[model samples]
Target: MIPSFPVDVERIDPLLASEVRRHYDRGGRTISFCSGSFLLATLGLLNQRTAITHWRYAEQFKQRFPHITYRDDSLYWYDGRIGCSAGSAAAIDLGIAVIRDDFGYEYANAVARRLVLPAHRDGGQSQFVQKPLAPVNAALAKVLDRAVKHSGSGSTVEQIAAKANMTRRTLDRHFIRHFNMTPHQWLCERKLEVARQLLETTHLSVEQIAGRAGFDNAVTLRHNFNKYLSVSPTKYRQTFKSSQQPF
Candidate 1:
């Protein structure tokens, strides 16, 4: 980005790919706005890092860099050292966040209002999605996500299939075609991811987490966590959780 403060504009050309790598290696804050994420990827700064770009370009980004964990379908993603904004306008939100970090909320809000935009946002994408997908797809996603959202006490593939008015075979085929994963595999991964995020962010008891995450019991939760993460919930929390970020 053009520095907020004054710098010789003529010197911008001297900033090379190698220089960007040095900055990333030194653990400095680095960001790319929408398509600009390519600059980082082109320079190899995204190795082993999870990042996002706009949805339209996700496949191209992945095809170009198969080694990196590019999750551009999301509105945004922030790894510790690098961050990427999704759609072009999301850059404004990222800018506001940066201003808030560097200055404060007052300054960020003033800048946002002066720019004729909202002050802040709480969740992910706000814009309505363009495509018209099926309710069955959404219901399936809800059931899969429900493992974490409602703690797995609700919903299963058979239940989802019944609600979607499809047979089990049809649902299984759809899951394979769209997600390249079986229903059980997808559910397990989704549950584990939710459990990890919760463990890292909250002080919820294991029993509560199990209940909320649809693990049936703490024993099941512990078993799944160990199988996937190679660490127990308590140990994983101790190692990974430093602070929580609210949704």
Candidate 2:
């Protein structure tokens, strides 16, 4: 794992570069946090591979490594072999992903809970999210939890806001301030998380998963899965399930 470092380092020590290259050549996994991507790019490990660094360095990194596919919007990214976190906070999310991949969803979630962190955050989430000023009110939090619990019912943003006794505009403001996203986006993310958990832990069919996830249908689920994850639900299930370490 490569931690954040000065991206402006003019030259990598030859020995360190040689070691990193040797590790890659032997099919070792690689993970970089923040500007650590610079090291990976310098060695051409990121060429033609999707990568992300802190948004502050996006322009400079892209200019210097045009061959690397830089995803500015992603908070973190992983392609089985290589992984990257966009910033320090994102490093936690990526670390949890690594734990989930190595151990199992339940084990990872348990670990996250012990650390007082959210169990997961999708890798494709934007990097520009602002830190929330405070936690949501109890009513609003309860509504959000219920929405996730009954995601299959396809609750609309208006209905959810109403359940929390807030106007749509008010709810939007709260969501943006606390979650750095609109209510609809948060709802979609929650649904997607539910879908992913089911995929990882159950034998449910795609159509069934779609309904449970609050997607309009299986086709919509497939489309959203591909758009956000660059992988089909079936393929994602196979990848995670096959590689999942027994708890």
TM-score of each: 0.52, 0.70
Per-residue lDDT of 89-121 in model 2, one digit per residue for the tens? 888878887777665567778779887988664
- Per residue, candidate 1 scores C-alpha lDDT tens digits across 208-232 of 8887777788999999887765669
Local distance difference test, per candidate? 0.63, 0.81
- The residue ranges of model 1 lying beyond 4 angstroms of the native Cα positions read 1-12, 15-19, 46-79, 84-86, 89-150, 177-180, 189-204, 226-232, 239-247
Query: Residue 137's C-alpha lDDT in candidate 1?
Result: 66
Q: How well does candidate 1 score on lDDT at residue 33?
A: 77
Off by over 4 Å in 2: 3-9, 25-27, 33-38, 41-81, 84-92, 101-104, 113-116, 124-134, 242-246
For every model shown, the clashing-pair count is: 4, 0
What's the lDDT for residue 173 in model 1?
A: 89
Which candidate number maximizes TM-score? 2
